[model samples]
Every structure is written in C-alpha cells, then in structure tokens.
Target chain A: MPTLYIDLMSQPSRACYILCKKHGLPVDVQMIRLDKGEHKKPAYLQINPLGKVPFLVDGDLRLPESAAIMAYLCDKYSLPDNWHPGSSSSSGQAAAHQQQQEQQRRAVYESAVHWQHLNIRAGCMRLVFHTVIGPRVFKVPAVPQVAADGLKVLQQALKDMESYWLGGGSRPFLTGQQVSTPDLLCVCDLEQLRMMVAEPSQPQLEQLLAPHPIVRQWMAAVRAAVGPALYDEAHGKLAAAVARLAAAAAAKPAARL
Target chain B: MPTLYIDLMSQPSRACYILCKKHGLPVDVQMIRLDKGEHKKPAYLQINPLGKVPFLVDGDLRLPESAAIMAYLCDKYSLPDNWHPGSSSSSGQAAAHQQQQEQQRRAVYESAVHWQHLNIRAGCMRLVFHTVIGPRVFKVPAVPQVAADGLKVLQQALKDMESYWLGGGSRPFLTGQQVSTPDLLCVCDLEQLRMMVAEPSQPQLEQLLAPHPIVRQWMAAVRAAVGPALYDEAHGKLAAAVARLAAAAAAKPAARL
Candidate 1:
C-alpha cells in the first residue's frame, strides 16, 4: 500500500485523498498539517525536501506534487478510464484509429491538467492566500491589490475553462463526458474562494462561479461523480473552516448590541 | 504531419520548437507573433479559441499547452526513452522491478513538469512581464513591488530546483541524467530574464544564474545535449530582442551627449 501524506485543508491534497478513496485504492493516509507547520519540520523534510503536502511513498518511490501522485496511482492500480482517460493502459496493440483518438483524449486531458496548475489553481490559491488564509490564519495583513488581481485572473481562468474546456456546455466535464482528475482538481481549487465571501446561503464559490454557469454545472457533475460522502470527507477541514468563519461573522453583529 | 503555431518570443513556444527540431519530428511551423497581437486576432482564435501560441493541430485533433504537445509528439513518434524516460513505451511484459523503477522515474518527471508550470516558469514570466516585457513590449508601466515579488519567487524556485530537482548537483537533469522537456522549459523561462538586465559581456541570464551554479551547469548540459544550431534557431527571436534592448540602451547615452 502506498502512503499518502496529505492535509485536507490543501486543495490538491484533498483531491488526491478523494481519488484514492473513491477508487478503493488502499492507501495509508498520514496527515501532514500545513497550519501547524508539520510539513516544514526536519522529519517530513527528510521524506520530501520541498516540504509540501500530498507526498506519496510506496516501496522505494517517493513522489511529491498531487497531479503526479494521482497519475501514478491511476497507472499503478489500473483505475477506470473515466478517472484519467487512456492514462492507465498504454497505447500498445490498439488499432490505428483508436490509438489516434486515445492520443487526442490524453493530450486534451494533459492540457487541462497543466492549465489548471497555472491558471485556475494558481489564481484561486493566490486569492485565498492573500485575502482569506493570510489574514485570518497566519495573522498577516491582506494585500488588497494582490487579492483583486488574483480574483481577476481567477475569473478569466473560469471563463477560459467554460469557453475552451467545457465547450460552452457542449462537453460535460473539463475534458469530456467522463470526469477526469483535472475536473476534480479545478473544482476543488475554485471552491477555495468560498472563504472569501458568503452569501445568504451560498458563499463566494457560488457567487464567483455565477458568471460561468457551465463551470458550476461541471463542478456539480464532478462532485456527484466522486460522491458526496468522499467529497465531504476530503473537504471536511475546509468546510469546517468556512463554518467557523461564518459563525464568527454571525456573532460579531449580536456582540455589538 | 502536425502543425505547431508558435511565437519564438514566447518561452513555452520556443521550448516546443526546440523539442520538435531536436527530435527531428516533421512539423509545419506557423508563426504567431505576439508583438502584432496576432494571437488575439479572430482567425487564429478560430483555430485555437484560447488564442495561445504553441497550439498543436494534427488532423482533427487540436491541442494547446507545450507540455501536452511534447508528450503527444513523444508518444506518436515513439521517441527515445531518455527524452521522456519510460513515457514512450508501455509497461507491458516488463519485470516487476523494472516497472517500479520506471514508474518512479515517470512520477518524478511529472512532478518536475507540473512544478515548473506553477513555480519556475510562472515566477520567471511574472518577473519578466512586470519588469521587462510589460514596460518595453506592451508599453505598460512597471510595477516595482510586483516585479520584486516575482523575483523573490523566481529565486526561491531556483533554490528549490537546486535542492530538490537537481539534488544538489547529484542528478544531471531535472529528474535524471538525461535532459527532459521540463529542463528545456525551465531553462528557457529563466533565460527570459536576459531581456531585463544585460551584463557588460554576458547578459542577465548569466548574472541571475550566477548564484545557482548547479542550474547553470544543468542548463549548459541541456543546451549542448540539444545541439547549438537547433537551440539557437529556436531562440533566435528572443536573442534578437535581447540584442535590440542592448543596442537601444547604448544609443541612449550617445543621444544624451
């Protein structure tokens, strides 16, 4: 069994955790708390010198980066095609036409995965770190300009996701009908904005995703595909953080009276 | 034959061009100049809705993102194992030990590739745009603070590359001894800083790379591995841009006198 070092608060970590659970891939889950700086300690650093969460260890192989970990798991365990799409089974002995189609699908999937890392994931993390996590958790003052820039980039990425990946609602997920890892990674990253602003019932996620209905629909599809239980379980820490923020804001008004 | 749309001015585009040329892949190169706003035009956007350079079109398949393009080309052409390292051939009929080793290598390469997208490539581009590209090419005022932050991130990423990816000069390439696509992409991105500060004899590329000797060595290895003719051909536009900046600066002193 591979040991997965993850912190649910981290977006990619939760994505990997949910992937392992959803696929029934037996993985040893070891929590590496980012908030507590456990990842930066000497012991964890020994395993992964970069000191990032979602490090995977199986036998002699030590891997960092969530996307790589997820890909490795998909290949090793031979998960279903929909999860990664043509990534597990190699392109050996397939017909020429089928091989070409599989190559295209894999190419599209790879592009979306890379796109998520740079744009959607990077932008959302930038916004959350500057606005929510930095100020609230780390006690660092929020940089309004940086946060605003992040929001702008995030919105643009969402628009690109809708226009290019989702094909203006023509395709269901980021790549295709079957939900892929990028879909899960992207939805989880965008959901981080929920900590920014809360609506009457919904939070920043719903509002920020308001302009891109296609993206929201895609996110819903990915969540449903992963099932609500595993999704909630993986995101339990983040959800709790959102609830606490809400409770604190709700109490501030009554305390003034 | 596939068609590659690229602007040598763009870092990823140049990297892709170098990959195809070095591997001797038959590709029809279509130049999309960023200086003329060609990428944003309607016709090009029709081909690639994202309007990004380094879009690969093969028959009915349309692919964007440099890494994806390189991966697809490697698979389609069945390129050497060293270029991608276990990516070309499947794990069919391989011994269990060899399979595990191959998986580990592929995982590391994937991590480095994804890490480059978010950190090294991103930070370098951010710094260059804020300091060099924005002020010079786009006529946008340079944001000193943003540039400084970008520099900080870029330097940290270099240090991480040294510590983790390069393994303190233990590994010859990003993942292993053989030069990979991530190595090409990263070195190209870092070289973009040459536009910002030109040294007396050497340029900003050398000055910025001075602190990280391991990275400098790794870069020299990649350049030599790819051969100078193709590498220089791919980076010709960028080299000309850097030369133009130096010339303009030299002429400014005479004008002042």
Candidate 2:
C-alpha cells in the first residue's frame, strides 16, 4: 500500500486526493498538517527532501511533486481513462509497442500542453497571483495589473480549451471531454475561484465560463460526483481563509472611517 | 513533420528546444516572432489563443508549455535512457497502461512540486524580481540585498540538486545523475543564470556544482553531448540581451551624471 500525502485545500494536493478517491485507487491518505507546517518539518523532508506535499511513498520509491506522483500512480495502479493520455503498452511485443509508446507520449504531451493553455491553469494562476501576492502583500488597490493580466491569460486559455473540449460538435472534458485528469484539474481550481472570487453568479464571471456548456455541465457533475459533503469539507477551510481576508479588509482604517 | 511554434529566447521555449534536440526528436521550428507581436495574430490564436510561444504541433496535436512539450516528446519518442526514470517493464499488459496514465499526472505534480519550493524558483524569481522588475521597473537601487536574496534561492536549489546528483550513484543527471527531463530543465534555466547574474564563476555558483561531483562530471558530459558550439549558440542570445541591458542603463542621463 502506498502512503498518499496531502493537504486538502492546497489546490494541487486536493486534486490528487480527489482523483485517487474518485478512481477508488487503493491508498492510505496521510495528512501532512500544513496549518502546523508539518510539511516543512525534518521528518517529512526525509520522505521528500524538498519538503513539499502531494508526494507518494511506497516501500522503496519516494516521489514528491504532484505531477511525478500522478505519473507514478497512473503507472502503478492503471486507472480508468483520463489520467494518463500518452504512454503505456500492455502488449510487450514490438508490433504494439509503437502504438503503446505513442499513447504514453500523447498522454504526457496532452497533460503538459493543456496545462499551459487551459482555463484550469489560467483561472487558478490568476487566483493564486492575486490572492497570494496581491494587495495583501503588495498592498495595491485592485491588486496589480498582473492579476488582471493573469486573468486575461486565463480568459484566452478558457476560450481555447472550450473549443477543444466543449466548444466542438461532440464536447466533453478538457481533452475532448470524458472527464479526465484535466476536468478534475478544472474543478479543483474552479472550486477555488468559486471560493475566492467575489461573485460566481455574475455575467462576466459567467462569460469566462460561458463558452463551453459541457464544461459548465461537467463542473456541476463533478461537484455532484465528488459529493457536496466532501466538496464542502475540502473547500471549507479555504472559504474560512477567504472570510478572514474579507474580515481583514473590513477592519482596515479606511473601511472603519 | 511537427511544427514547433516558438520564440527561441523565451526560457520555456528554450527548455522545449533543448529537450527535442537532446532527445533527437524531429520538429519543424516556427517562430511566433514576438518582436512583431505575431503571436497575437488570429491565425496563431486559432492554434493557441493564449499567445505564448513554444507550442508544438505534432501531426494534429497542438501542445504548449516547455514542460508539456518535454513530457509529450518523452512519451512519443524512443528517447534517451534518462529522459524519464524507472525501469522498463516486461509485463506489457499492466505496466504499460499504468505508465501512460501516470505520465501526465507526474508531469503536473513534479513541475508543481519543484516550482512551489523556493529553492530554484526563489533564485530565478529573485533575478526577475531584482534585475527585471526591481532595479529596472520598480526603480529600486541595485540593492545587494535583493540580488543576494535571489542568489540564496539559487544556492539552496543548487545545493540540494548537487548533493542529490553529485554522488557515486548509478544515474548521473540532476535527479538520478542520468539525463532525465529534470536535468534538461535545470540546465536550461541554469544556463540563463550564468548570463543574467554577474560573476558566473563565483563560489556560490560553484558550490551548487560542488556537492555533486557526478553532477559536475555530468555537466561536462551534457556540455560535450550538447556540443560547445550549440551550447554557446543557445546561450549567446541571453548574453547579448544582458549586455544590451547594461549598455542601455549606461546611456541613461542619470547614470551619466
């Protein structure tokens, strides 16, 4: 049994956990206490000298980084469909080997390519850029233009991805639908945006998500499938953090005056 | 033939080009011509609306981001031994399928893990912060503190990577001592550092190379393998860019005074 290490609300970490549970891959969830900085401690560093989360530890193999972990797990357990898009060959013979290799290559390529051009990364990076380094740290009014710029990048990404996945005649997940790793990625980050951004109900926000009805529908399905209970459990802490941020904003001298 | 839609100087694009060349993958180089803002043209937008460079078109596949490209190529090609890690499988059925699915998962996870840690990122970001944004845009003095801070992150990453790879171990790349994707990643970014930072041969720079004698040996090997002429060709532009920056700074009236 592999020991799956994570912190629920730490976007990428949550994605890994959700997928593992979603696919019903057999694993043990070892919560690395991020709030207490257990992730930074020496003991955990032995597992991952880099001292980061979303790492996996098997008997001999210890891997850190979510992508590395995802790769290791996909190869190790062989999940259903979406996780791995490229490589892997079941038939050892030279005949199918090329096709298998092509599959693996395709999977790796798809994941990497879509990541840069997808709304999942686009919206997520914007949220991170703003909330993580925005007015809070840089003390700017509407955050920096970089935050807006990040959103623009994401907006373009969403448009591109929507066409590929949901914009088409058929439409599905990030990689032509079918609810693969990319879809989960979108939901994981989108959930964060839904938690972070002020109005999820507004038209501009909806416009960002408007292109692909499949994405919208899939988002709803994913929220339902992941279960509203776990969804809230996973996102509740992040919500509280947002609340604290809002409270702090309210507590400011200008706000009080 | 695959079309590589790219601007060669961009750091991520450089990572893609090196991986393709180093692994001996064939690609048709298509410049997005950043200087003319050609990336924003609708024709290119049809390919990648985000307007970033180093997007790859393999047959019908269009992928972006260096990390994605590397993953895609590694998956698609026969590949050099160290491009990916782990033993090759004999059981084609289970092993191949598992590997394909996880490849994307790992790509996402590893890049995230590596970037999240301040080690290499801190240094790279510090350089961008100090040199690109700080002194240049933000109008801070050539604050030794800021540059020094950048060096610290660089040092820490080098120390960690060197100690791990600079060993009497089997593999000889950054992660395992053999040339893996991470090795390609490190070298690409490190080459930029050599130019952008002053005093390339400084001890802190060497200290990063020191812990791993294997890494040092491997660096020589990568240099040799990559060919000194090509290595110089690739990095030569960055060197010129830095010099241009310095000359422009010198030409400023305030500096003249």
TM-score of predicted model 1? 0.95
Residue-level lDDT of model 1, residues A3-95, one tens digit each, is 999988889988898899998889999998888889999999998888898899998888988999998898788898877765565656888
Docking class of 1: medium
DockQ of 2: 0.27
Candidate 2 local lDDT, A84-167, one digit each (tens): 553233555566656655554455435533463224554555555454534443353333333554565566656556565455
Question: Per-residue alpha-carbon lDDT of model 1 for B47-119, expressed as tens digits?
Answer: 9998888999999899999998888888788888776755575757889878777777888888888889878
TM-score of each: 0.95, 0.73
The candidates' DockQ values read: 0.66, 0.27
- What is the i-RMS of every prediction? 1.7, 6.3
Give per-residue lDDT, candidate 2, residue B12: 64
Clashes of each: 0, 39
Off by more than 4 A, model 2: A86-88, A92-109, A112-160, A163-170, A194-215, A224-233, A236-257, B22-25, B85-171, B194-221, B246-257
| Alpha carbon lDDT of each predicted model | 0.83, 0.59
| Clash count (model 2, backbone only) | 39
